[model samples]
Target: MTPVLDPDTSLWHVIALEVQRQRIAHDLSVTQLATRLRVDRSTVSRIEHGWRKLSPEQADGLDAMWDLQHLFRRLVRFAAATDDGNWFTGLMDFEKEASLHRMWEALLVPGLLQTPDYARAMISTKSADVEAGLETRLARQASVFDGERAPRVSVILNWAAIEQCVGGRDVMRGQLAHLLEMGERPNVNIRVMERDAGAHVGLDGSFRLLTISDREIAYSASPERGRLVLEASDVHDYAVRYDLISNLASPVGASRRLIEQALEA
Candidate 1:
């Protein structure tokens, strides 16, 4: 049986449900719908499950097929107009529930591994209440790192992020020391990607893949905002990217030595 999407989740969810409903009403199988859209079968599945956004072109194709007078295209525009500024908020909730986390950061320490001072230094530029945001970040770290039920975490961080001072020398030293300490935990693994490795796949950006309950979620962020990805195929791509990054990273022991070297330098 095909699962139904809860229409109230988001406008995209409503669009997905409508697409699925129209396809079924016209006696079309998923494969048939995919053929009509000139997209892969998996694309149709992702759309129906609200895991992927319906693209403008795909919406036009569907509207033409069903003679819906561009209804899907109009819905897509409306969904695009609404700013999902709460994506990071959603990420916080997912992080608390995730059982396994694989993260890759090219420029800075991952937030879960940041010292309060380091976190504050970055948060202060964007937030009106630095202390409040700092408190929330500390709480998030405690939830993921201090508890017995803490998730298994693997991090691949660029060496430059360790070498470059954040929050001045004292705070940078504390952050490095904190990373070394966190790396000692049995459930946490940290590896460093050397700057000398030339260019690599991770140079594009930072991303994290999390396993929550039994489902996988991926997140990629820019300075403006972050996006939460739920499509299985897209999440798998992130997993593969993580593996590629791990290949270029130093082993945990070597990474520890690198951190120790930076602390001394």
Candidate 2:
């Protein structure tokens, strides 16, 4: 089943056609193609239908095997940068579709990891439509808890996020308790970066990395500068920062203990 390729808004469809055209050029059937590429037949189907976005590895592998002149990689990036306005809207869409969601939150609790009360308190300061924004933020958490097929979630939290009482003691108590519950999920890994993990790469600020199919995009911001960076270089830079923070963070067990300790205090 082939879908119409809207070339303007759908550079992703352009990639699908390029992959299909090249596969047929080589006279390989879907099953044959999957066998030859060592990927699942379903993967090929999804790519052809634009139902799944390609990772850089998948794109590069296809390029090397089929000689597609690197057009595949360029198109994948173009698709990621499709929307210029409402960065959060683009991010929410990405979060919904991403196979993996990861973040190094330096100052405040991440939305997906926040309790409704904590989120309400945090948003109250900036969001004019507090009720709608709170609902949207809470809804986003659904991505992390969708049964066994839920996206993998890894959150590295700065110790300050736990210590600060964003919505006073009762709200923080709920938030920490919620984190403890989320951390126990098989697909969720929560780590804490201690205050003494000073002079780390994450010292710059907080950022989120979403892995869609195989490619990853990152969002980072500060009061002075904020951006949704789509380039491989931008993603690569965050990955490096993430690694450094992870290395210094408390182990999962220790992180949970820290949360428990904070709850008691």
Candidate 3:
């Protein structure tokens, strides 16, 4: 049965429903389809209900089962080409299958390690719709611990990010401590670009590089609008810019010291 459309149904949901239709049209039951896809029945149900995203492998399995090899390949290509929807939703989907994440933040603490207070302050300051914003941000943070394989993440923050004092000294202290804890993880690297480091490409804004298999997609945020995902030549240019910014940024050791100094101040 086709699921009723709800305001919350995303593009992923539409795609999932299409897959289900094809399966049923081919006389395949949910269990048979799940077995063919090598995923649990609940996984199939979640994907259909838009409660979960399909990995590239799972998408491929469904494509083959539904005799949609060409269309499935195209959908996967589109998924790889862009970072997808809302910022938080896109982050969850990207992190799920990414092998590496390259990030830069100019004005605020990166979301992954933000304390509740800091996150609250950020949302309150920026979001016109605070209630929805808070829920989305919190949900995004929760996804970091969901998957079995976490991506290797490298984040570069502007020194100004530490000095801003978003939620006051005590909150800043908690945030700095959180950063220190997160940096100690074997798969994560954090760096800070000093204020007087001279001009750099990242001065424009913050952006992310998400590596899915052999392809890398880029996303940037705008103050007036929302997020924009980059592809092809645009992704390549942002990558070059990111590399230049990283080069100008302080080394990890110095960055940690900078954070410590900010916390003390």
- What local distance difference test score does each model get? 0.88, 0.82, 0.76
- Candidate 2's C-alpha lDDT? 0.82
lDDT of 2 by residue, 184-224 (tens): 88889999998777788887889989898778999886654
Model 3 C-alpha lDDT per residue in residues 22-87, reported as the tens digit of each score: 877889888887888877899888777767766778777666666664555545544444444335
- Please give the range of 10 consecutive residues that has the lowest summed lDDT in model 3: 80-89
- Using lDDT as the yardstick, the better of models 1 and 3 is 1
Query: What is candidate 2's TM-score against the reference?
Result: 0.69
Give the candidates in order of lDDT, highest first: 1, 2, 3
- Structure candidate 3, residue pairs in collision: none
Overall local distance difference test of candidate 3: 0.76
Top model number, lDDT = 1
| TM-score of candidate 1 on Cα atoms, chains taken together | 0.71
**Following a full C-alpha superposition, what root-mean-square deviation does model 3 have from the true structure?**
8.1
- Candidate 2 pairs with clashing backbones: 55-214, 55-215
- Backbone atom clashes (below 3 Å) for every candidate: 0, 2, 0
Scored by lDDT, model 1 comes in at 0.88
Using all chains and alpha carbons, the TM-scores for the candidates as numbered come to 0.71, 0.69, 0.69
lDDT of 1 by residue, 1-265 (tens): 5555676767788999899899999999999999988889999999889788999899999999999976787577657754455567767766887899999998999999999999999898798999999999998888777777879999999988898888899999999999999999899999999989888889999999999776788999788887887669999998899999999899999999999999988
